[model samples]
Target: MEVSVNQDNFSILECFSSPTRIRIIELLNERPMNIRSLSEALDIKPPIVTRHIQMLEQAGIVASELIAGKRGQQKLCSLKLEQMVLNFRSQIHNKKPSVQKYDVMIPVGMYADYEVKPSCGLASEHSMLGMCDDPRYFADPVHRDARVVWFSSGFIEYRIPNYMLYNEQASSLEVSLEICSETPCSSSHLQPSDIVFSFNGIDVAVWTFPGKIGKGTAIFTPQWWHKDIQHGVMKHIRVNEQGTFIDGVLVSNMTIDALSLCADEEIVMRISSRSDAKRCGGVTLFGSGFGNYNQDIHCTITCK
Candidate 1:
């Protein structure tokens, strides 16, 4: 899992603040070692080494397991993070003059309309909402608490409130959500699938998720979540005067003006799999209580 360095991660950062822990990470990078070996190599007391390991393990920087050894059961330690990047820019928030912004988060199961095929299912954090592949479950009242929703085909549509844009000109619009290609179970196959995003009947962008994602556990996924089924990635799709962007990188020439959005018009956001896609891996939407990023379908409109 990737995490940005910020105030929220101060505890994690503190784990790296110690020289002894830093050396331990370097030693573990070479190979997994027991507490005795680490103590000997670092020339530190065994108790001191154990204390450092506990802190590292709590911060998810290192992992330890007990195994039979020549003397007795020994704890094996290994590094979890292969790389770390520190960026100061993420902490800075820029404010613009005369800009009014409205933000809304749509829960995964609260779609205005939907049509799904087999292999579809919905689950809350605690348990499955209903029988898998049963389309009727989409309309179930209990779906409102759904944390994850997956389907083999079809689309899900949402109606975003546009009253905030009334009498104001929208300078830009952004829709961010966590999504991934769907499969029977987590597979390693990197099949190409075209996922389209449309706004107000205009095709804004068609992103191709490389494959079904599920090698490891998501950072925020609940403990009860099945290990075999993993969380999707967080993606940001933006439309502005400059053009359309996915995760801050331009992917299309479509601009906000082309949408022809009206001040009082309700915005229609639709996500669908292209019928002509070479591979139909399906789609999964993650909500606030699920996935690596604990967020729902977030929509932000910046007006001037």
Candidate 2:
């Protein structure tokens, strides 16, 4: 099935549409299940399930194995799509001078300032003072007492120190963050909305959210949250000789060298909403409180 993707795109929607295929994905998402178990749960004939399983295997969505069993060899199946993204970019290439490399992970809470309030299920994980979800969460003298949940029309800014930059050396900067939908809900059904990541003053990248928490993946979440809608993912971007990127794909034709930041310049990654913003795709900035998952969301700059 043909579909449109935003940036760093991968095709998996086709695999998700078939009822049988989706069931297979869900079952495997929890743990590897043998074909017999899946067949019973789906209530489909074993042969029919086998046919669908083959299709899924070809699509790289499922994998099967032969295990020793009394009846014979049992085939097991599992999911491969940890997270799927649809990314598109205008260009890739740079004509300007290059700089030095630097890498770092910006935690969720270490910003110049931020506003957060209690959403459902945050009180137990975080000590709450009031019954409402208000801006007061940011005012708590102690961050541990602050509500872990928050949404923003505003930006969570990160200030990159100047020491990282070096003159005329080839380098690129990468950033990682943990983010999700603002409106806490199950079965995330919100429409596509834009979330912008800016570096310096340039509009570096724009990502569209599928809505709700579980659509991608998440971190430091309470068990009470439904699993289906609690998804979140890490987007890798490069600011190198090849220009800006969300993954390996270029955000523009301009290469990293062209998007110049002087050695002494301060860099900012502003996560904010689009003008047509509809849902609360507000982000969760994870740092010291939320340990890094390594691949979830990371920013870096590298050079020879």
Candidate 3:
């Protein structure tokens, strides 16, 4: 999870203020456990442990669900974030160069082009778009309303409306979205898929998603939605003169210059998994209504 180091992320930052909360995270990291188990291990009361878990949940750092325990039912808690980066740059991006920039929220369903196969389907906040595991449903007229989309193979493309003027040259581009491996609803199935990101049809970044279907519900996921794929890791794909980065880690040497974007040219971003990829597991895209983040595919462009 990437959080800007500012007042906007005060809740996330405050998560580290309490020793009890820190210890709780350390314990959950070992394995998923119930609040009763946590209370016993930490020598704390179950009520206090539940309160701590609630604070962590508010920060999107922990996930919990009600399940049948040996006695009856209990709230099972688990660590949700594998890594967290407090980015200081995001809050100060307008320091130098041109301030001419724009941000857009492109819904996951608003794909301009796509080529997908079975084990695929999409749904909005209220209901499924069409039939599950059917490629034909992807073309249904109402698909534009999809907030959660998944496919076992192939690619999906979206048009990022370029807002730069003819005299403007892009200095950097950043896109953030929630994604995970596509797999049938099974907590045991942790599918790892190599997902490739391209701009204007040119491959720029590639990363392997260590996917797992969580049993707990996402922060923004509606109650009607199934726990098939609870939530996905939020990823930040950035392109600059230096190189391409995924979550601040350089994934490719390919620089932003490779895109060669021009005026009146809408950038085409393609997310694909090669058929021969060693880990051709699949992909799932989460949007405003179905993931931890209550936002769509966010694109930001800064130009000079």
Best candidate, TM-score: 3
Ranking 1 against 2 by lDDT, winner: 1
Candidate 2 lDDT by residue in tens digits, 146-224: 3233354556565765454354444567665545555342224444447777777677777776553344443344445
TM-score, cand. 3 vs. native: 0.70
User: Global lDDT of each model?
Assistant: 0.79, 0.54, 0.83
Candidate 1, residues 111-169, lDDT tens digits: the string is 88888876788888888899888989999898888888877778888898885645788
TM-score of each: 0.67, 0.53, 0.70
Ranking by TM-score: 3, 1, 2
How many clashes (backbone N, Cα, C below 3 Å) per candidate?
Answer: 0, 40, 0
lDDT of 3 by residue, 1-304 (tens): 4588899789889989999999999998766678988999999999999999999999999988876667898888877665687888783746645468778999999998899978788889998877888889888878899998888889999999999999999877889898888643323365889999999888998889976554466766788986567678778898988899887788888887889978788999999977889998888899987766656999988888
The local distance difference test score of model 3 is 0.83
Error of 3 at 26 (Å): 11
**Residue 29 C-alpha lDDT in model 2:** 69
